[model samples]
Target: MKTPEAGDAIAAAPRRGPLHGLVVLDITRVVAGPYCSMILADLGARVIKIEHPDDPDYVRGFPPFVGEGDDRFSAFFAQYNRHKEGITLNLKHEAGRELLKQLVARADVLVENFRPGTMERFGVGYDTLRAVNPKLVYAAISGFGQTGPNALRPGFDNSGQATGGLWSMNGYPDRTPVRVGTIIGDVSATLFAAIGVLAAVREAERTGQGQMVDVSQQDAVLALTENAVVKYTVDGEIAGPLGNDHPFVRPYGQFPCRDGHVFFGGYNDKLWALSCRKFGTPDLVSDPEIDTMAKRFDPEVYARRVKPVVENWFRERSKAELEAMAGDDIPLCAVKNIREVVEDPHIAAREMIVDVDYPQGRIGMFGTPIKLSRTQAQASGRAPNVGQHNAEVYADLLGIDAESLQRLKSSGVV
Candidate 1:
């Protein structure tokens, strides 16, 4: 049986997404960089993922491997790497470096998440690549930005969270800081990187000149500091963790339900009155000390009156019951766990959960959340195998033959 080729598989598939004609040279691994490229690939860009011939991506060895022996695959790797062609290239070698330059010449975008100078050391940095492909959108995601004093400092999601002030704003006020459940910093940095790449790609199309997109995970997290930074800068206030509560909003935050927790809160008088009406507590709405935003949000007033009343109301009802009553009247949500989130009716109706077929079987993955009226994106296929498109990409794009491809593989140049 003939083996399937990577670029051929995507190229043969019908092109329906908005980014149909774009080509992305994906030199990223792990979360942030791969995620940015994966978004491009999902939007119908032909993303060629370049890796080292010997080591490949470290995430390929991550746990929850399926199948047996050498064929085992990592679920973690598959999560962010779907819908891209994988190719191995030993960039340390001059032959491999030239091969990448050739690919770069034809690519529209290139994304990498290595430390600041790693790509330069490999001789494939933005400066070198832009010399070859003047219109290529080059994006880099790192812990800090490219030119900061700490740009060379090793950083990860945890580092971004801690240093960017997100850690200080989470958890209860009395407890030590806690990392968020997921790597929000890494994920947000990827999203910002994608946005940067798309914007640069647009400008490049107009001017025929590509630019660099430098995204720092720490900077991304700092950008999302919300009211924390501003409050300090403006009001001389230092915000601390409020335990599931909104810092400046009363009756807003997590509360107890009969079965599980509910996130129900009111920020303004109108919503607070709506909440009071829903809970059959109209008298509280007229209470002089807690009628206004300033009064209601005051810590002492909230602890003495507002929180107790709202918490008592929610505690008596099941999450479903509360949800039914609060429908559109107030902003309330049942704090859902992973299983609940996946199985949610709203999530399913919105097509946020989708089935993706793999070699072993079908598994459900989070679907594209960017809904558009004109051109829709899709999760085209499963992740590719290691160097899965050597013959096809090299032959079709670089004009190398099957025999030469094999020779390159034997010499570890590809």
Candidate 2:
């Protein structure tokens, strides 16, 4: 596929997503905010990403570059910012702030991830933008939230994980709890912010009034701790990491194979019996000591009677061999690394990985997980260079011709 020129992509290639006609003004940088607007862009919203004229998105300077020197681009930024139009504006400048207000007046949604009062400091906060366009769905994503006591504090992905209590329940119980392998806090908050934006947009369409949608990274991560809070409250028991072992299920954890590891879930009676039969120990199914599910769940019994046999059986077989043996009867899966995942036939069949073309070459990125019957939800364009669409956007939206745009650029307002 040929790569479209930076400014021309959005104009030339029309989106066929469910939000085809929705216009989004994205004043967000980095993961949480960019990820949210990226979702909207993938779903067919016309997203216009505005960055600071002097200081662009920090990720644009990050490593893992493609091309050389002046032409080099950050693959990290590209993956999350694809399918959106790009422009630059100096929010600190009066004319620039006014320009943003004008854009907001015409936009259906505006998303920002700055600290709670950052936008308000610049005179373009939700209240200001809402006043400009009452129907605008304003989404504010932050570490704490817009109204909390900690809203003024600076926060990052790790801050969310730590503050939300997710970090306390991860990793082995004997060691210090570790943060999740990926940026779950930011990503979860992104998903929630997108949902909020969509819901607010729907309500706006119904009543011709838009409201603020505030999402906190810490709040989102706390919501994802899933029963940990209830476990502590109801049973008066604090949950800690069990080193991949389920607290209740006996044989529902990862075990080593000849080459690597595989997760086995023969915790139930029927599956346990099937697993025991497959291990060439059908007699163990009726064994008095470890026969029933309840008995198997006992840690001492599992360690003494079941773990040894299960480990011995697994150690003798490679991952592929164990998978073949388990087939569909026993719930088992070989733990795969990134390389295997990229090469797996199942992932390919589902179109979970895709490539976006750049001026220099193509960079591979994860495809959209959303599937719709009537509309497409995929990354169909490349990330734009800073201010790549300034002329196009300014001309089309604000009626700024080439000379006026050059003046604005020279004045450092754009």
Candidate 3:
């Protein structure tokens, strides 16, 4: 309950989960398969997930955990279901698809996204779970792939960012296509379905077996701009959006300040000449068209020369005094919302918000961006419930018992 600071603990720790003793099997769902099994349960994979108990997770009922006071389950389904282990099953019965093929014969991995041929019409795809785990891996994720021609349509992440042109280069050049305010194509197709299940779990730990990866969310938003596909293949120009500015960088972006907005990037020419000497205008940083960011798009010729002297010196400064008058000489920030980014003080000294508890109590929980230094990773619980590991992953990974897990949950199959 402390650590967070080295730049918000490298964006809120969690790196060590290098799939500690593997064993996934999520069977995936919303948010690109629960964000690729919560990034392989934050690198320590021991996932299990499943879910169904009379159909739950449509992001457990979506919303910042449905509240007008007591709805439950969501904070967007506990932000991609923390470190796994929930349960419940029906898999349209056959003893719950033979209890997910005997938990894929003791799984090594087996995510999913269900759509493109809905797991080969539920025989549990990947060639029937590689005949019950020939060293598994499996992954899938979808929306626009998993077998061509719009693989049975139905996507989202706003239709895979407007069919993958990333909402036609996202907002502002005469407005319209925006969408990037989160769910960036379902967290970039859940980081390419956790990099295709850690490259098929490092080739099933060196060819003991396993394969079938897939992934797609419109091919991860067209591989997130191959530099706008090499500038629309060497200039037939089509890039749009310019809302906050910066593709190359000149006094970077968003500048209000005095009690609001304060971004800033200032790419070069000595941070746009230290933002024209802290806005007193040391001669508009030698103005070759607003000193080149390929010309700050001549926004009304640099807003009649330097946006009214940096918007009247940020109307007398305060986004922490123009972020302490641009310290590292540039690269600053401040445009926050969502209650100033969940009470940010560097997002609470970088734990990016923690405290979990669940059934909707302590709350918070939104960390992990990636960091390592001796294998960090976190969010060890919360987001379980529905069948919540029905008697510990059904008598330890299907060795069954407890009256065959209560006659497979009174024969509903779980």
Candidate 4:
């Protein structure tokens, strides 16, 4: 498949997504904001990224460049900001602010991730923008939200995980709290922002009035705590980590095998019996002290009677052997490393890993997970160079001529 450079004429391509013809002013940077914008872009929104001419997105400086010298580009930036157009605008300048207001006037949505008061100080808050375009859906993603005492404090993905109780419930009980391997906080916040913006956009279409959609990273992460919040409130139990095991379910965690690891879990009696029978330990199923779910909760009985039987069976078998023996109804899976995941046939068949060609080489990144029946998500394009669509957006959308654009560039207003 051919991947076009974002510098190519984006307007010439036919839009194939549900968000076709919608315009988005993408003023956010880094993880949460860019992630939301990327989803919009994939859905066929014409996202125009705003950046300072002198200092573009900080991720542009991150390592793992695809080329050398003038052609060098950050792969990190490409991972999140793909499928969006770019334009420079130093908001500190009056001309820049005026240009942004002009864009806002024509935009269907405006997304930002600045601290609570940042947009208000810049004179482009929801009220100011709504005054210009009443039907514009304004989405704001912040660390703690637009209100609350901690709204003014600077925050990042780490802060979201720490404050939301994710870190506390991640690791083993005896060890210190450990952050998750991936940035779940930022990713969850991004998804929540996208959902909020989409909901607001749908409502605006019906009511003819757009509203503000505020998403908090901390709140988003906290919503993913499963039963932790309820466990404390309802049962007076502060949930703690239990390693990879299910908190209340016995025999529901990773067990060591001969060559690799396998995770098989089922809380019900049927699954428990099947697991015991599959492991060639049918005798253990009828053992009085370890038969029922209630009896399996005792660590002493589990270690002495149950653990040894399960371990002995798994220790003699390989992951592949165990998988072959267990049927589909049995919840069994081999723990795959990154390389194995990249090579998995299921992932390839699902198109999870996709490639985008650069001037230097082809780079692989995870594709959009959302699949629509009629409208498909696309990632087969290069990330834009800094301000790559300046002339096209300014001259075409804003009706500024080449001479005026050059002047704007020279005066550091673009």
- Compared with the true structure, all predictions reach lDDT values of 0.85, 0.88, 0.73, 0.83
TM-score of each: 0.95, 0.94, 0.38, 0.93
Task: Let me know the TM-score candidate 4 reaches against the reference structure.
Answer: 0.93
List model 2 lDDT by residue over 1-414, tens digit each: 121221222232367789987888999998999999999999999899999988999999887888888899999899889988899999999989988887777688999999988889999888888787888899999999998679888889999999999999899989999899999999999999999999999999999999999999999999998888998899999878777888778988989999999999898899989998898989998999998999999999999998888898899799999999999888998999998998889888878788777887778878788988778797656988999999888876676789998998999999
Better of 1 and 4 by lDDT: 1
lDDT string, candidate 4, 1-414, tens digits: 122221233242255688887788999888889989999898888888899899888988887888888778888889899888899998888888778877877788899999898888878788988887788899999889988989888879988999998889999999998898898888999999999999999998899899999998899999999999998999999877778877776777888998989887744678778887877678767878777887776677766776666677678788888888876878887899988887889898888888999886677888888888888888666778889999888865667778888989999998
Q: Write the per-residue lDDT of candidate 3 for residues 333-352, one digit (tens) a residue.
A: 67888887888787777677
Colliding residue pairs in candidate 2: none
Candidate 2 deviates by what RMSD? 4.6
Flag the better candidate by lDDT, 1 or 3: 1
Rank order (by TM-score, best first): 1, 2, 4, 3
Ranking by lDDT: 2, 1, 4, 3
**Model 3 lowest lDDT segment of ten:** 3-12
**Model 1 lDDT tens row, 1-414:** 122222332232245588987888888888989989999888988888898988888999987766778878877788788888888999899989888888777678999899999999989888998898788899999999899799999889998998888988888888987777789999999999999999999999999999999999999998988899889999999878878877677777888889999988776999988888888999988889899988988989989988889888888789899989989878888999999999999999988887777776566778888887878888646888889987777765677878888888888898
Q: Which stretches of candidate 4 lie over 4 Å from their true place?
A: 1-13, 297-304
lDDT of 3: 0.73
Lowest lDDT 10-mer window, candidate 1? 1-10
Number of clashes recorded per candidate = 1, 0, 5, 1
Q: After superposition, how far is residue 242 of candidate 4 from its true place, in Å?
A: 2.1
> Clashes in candidate 3: how many?
5
